[model samples]
Target: MTISNDLFTRAQELIPGGVNSPVRAFRSVGGAPFFTKKAEGATLTTADDKELIDFVCTWGPAIHGHNHPVIRDAIAEALNNGTSFGTPNPYEVEMAELIIKMVPSVEKVRMVNSGTEATMTAIRLARGYTKRNKIIKFAGCYHGHVDSLLIAAGSGALTLGKPDSAGIPEKLAEETIVLPFNDLSKVEEAFSNFGDQIAGIILEPFPANVGLIFPTDGYLQGLRDLCTKHGSVLIFDEVMTGFRVSAGGVQEHVGITPDITTLGKIIGGGLPVGALGGKAEIMDHLAPLGPVYQAGTLSGNPLAMAAGIASLKLLLEGDAYSRLDKMGKQIASAIASTASEIGLPLQVPQVGSMFCVYFSEKRVDTLDDATATDTDRFNKYFHTCLEKGVYLPPSKYEANFISTAHEQGAIDRASEILCETLREL
Candidate 1:
């Protein structure tokens, strides 16, 4: 048996589902999940000693790619100072400052241990600020497993065929109004029905968890207007898209501001971190100043802050986003062109460095559409790419990522392989 297979056998004996995360189990795509020994640039050296051209990019961090020297040096420098401090450190101030400077909507920011924490805090802060109990989230928009945002969520939940997670109180789930994405009418209807009760509306701006679906024209702006009209906070869950999409993320790219923005992924520099940033007025509602209480001892770990600062600085250094976009298009276009040639029903909705392949004849714009994707064929395609040494996201419901570390040659090779695999299928 392969070393990865052996590792999985051991992992399942201890770790539930043989994986730390549900998607990592590869249940939707089938087959044993390979364990990675090391990663560098845009590749993962698997436990079996096979180097796979990584398109997952550590599930949407690694904008500069795995084990980047710059980020590594920053972390090493911070390590010299020590790990976590019970009190705040200089890195926390710097991270907060950097976040405020980069993301247009985030005036004040608070660091947390993970994207889930950031999102959870944002929800509580919103409710506290607006004095309301309900939150509206789009169907298939996964906001880090916060109980209130788990209704009809995406990511692992969608992959596992269970959108509404168990264990959440029925009343808590009721307070979360789940609506169709890319459809402003549903949001308008929700607001008309429960305008006064809505504390906030949280969304992924571009729903990457459910295969990178973008907002239709004016759809985001419409939500912005609705929140403003109702006095409800608009929360953009950019944990996936945040700094990876742009210096300011989708808010900056599309020019629609949100009251609160949840950030993680690239901002953590592949470390465990998350932050909630927003108007000072709303953020001040959090403890020490307001009633909403959120705390974490490891919120601003020096290593994560240092690494994230380095990652953000790298983006500010050159035309990194443009380069990543070019690479993304190269792969996305190749897949599209090949699928067209083979007359295979396909749609690869891509933006910046995030994209997903949907084997559907029509374009995908809603959660239902994403849920109804051709997973049967996609399972075949995913395994074929894995065998050919390209590692995409394990499930069709997840977004595939590209990074600046992906050399032109690597991207070209990946594109060629992906297209060839599609044709063969």
Candidate 2:
């Protein structure tokens, strides 16, 4: 057997599904996952010694690309200081200040261990601030593995949520209101009926988990206005899109301010980190300041802070975002052209460095549309591209990221491979 296959066999004996995360199992793409030996500059060197052009970008953390020297150097310097200290560190303060400067709505911020904690704390803070229990979340917008947030829609459009996973309590699910994404009338109706009861509305402004789906025109602004009218907090889960989308994220891009923003991925600079930040008035409700209690021992680890600082500093360098956007457009346009040439219906939604391919004629503005895409054809194309040395996000439902390391040549190469793969299909 191959080294990766052997590793998988050994891993399955110790780790559930032979992977730490479910999606890493490659279940959606129908194959055993490959183990990476090393990664650098938009490429993963597999344990079996093959190198592939990486589009997964560590699921959105490797914006500067894998193992960037700046981030690595920062981590090394932090190592001299010590990895973690129980007491607060200067790096924590600096990181918090940086976040406030980057994201405008965040007048105050709290560090957490993962996206789940960031979202969980945001939900609790909202409930405490509004004195309401119910929360509304758009369908297919993943906020993390938090129990309350791990819910799906019930039978009807406006029905109370049901647990998407087995371990989540049904009572917690009951307090969650599930609504179809991008449907403003349904949001208005829900607010009309249960506005007073809703503590908050949480969503990924540009939902990436279900595919890179964008909001309908004015849909996000409408949610913001409705939440304002109802006195419910609006939380944007920017775990995937936060720094990857822009230095300020979708809120900054669209000019729609949310009461609370949940961030992860790039903020940690490839380490484990998450943050919850928003207006100080609402954030003050959290402990040491207010009644709501949330804390983490490694919330602001020095190493994570150093890596983040370096990563953000690199992002601040000249024309990084412009380069990322240009690369994304290049790949997206090439894929569209190839699809047209092949007489195949395709939808490639892209913004900045994030993009996803949907083999469907319909525009995927909502989760329903995303789910209806031609996943079978996508699966075939995915493996074909992989065999040809382009590593995509194994699942068709996930978004593929273009990093700063994805220079024009690399982007063109990946695009050519993708087009050739598509044509073969």
What does candidate 1's lDDT look like per residue over 194-313, in tens digits?
Answer: 999999999999999999898889999999999999999999999999987788999999999999999998888989999999999999999889899999989899999999999999
Candidate with best TM-score = 1
Tens-digit per-residue lDDT, 1-425, candidate 2: 99999999999999998988777888777888899999999999999999999999998989999989989999999999898998999998999989999996899999998988999999999999999999999887888777888775211111112327778788889999899998999999999899899999999999888778899889999999999999999999998899878899999999999999999889888999999999999999999999999988998999998998888888988999999999999999999999999899999999999999999998988767776778789889988898999999877678899889887788889999989888888
Superposed on all Cα atoms, the candidates' RMSDs to the truth, in angstroms, are 0.8, 3.0
The residue pairs found clashing in candidate 2 are none
Root mean square deviation (Cα) for candidate 2: 3.0
Separate clash counts for every candidate: 0, 0
**Candidate 2, superposed: residue stretches over 4 Å from native:** 153-163
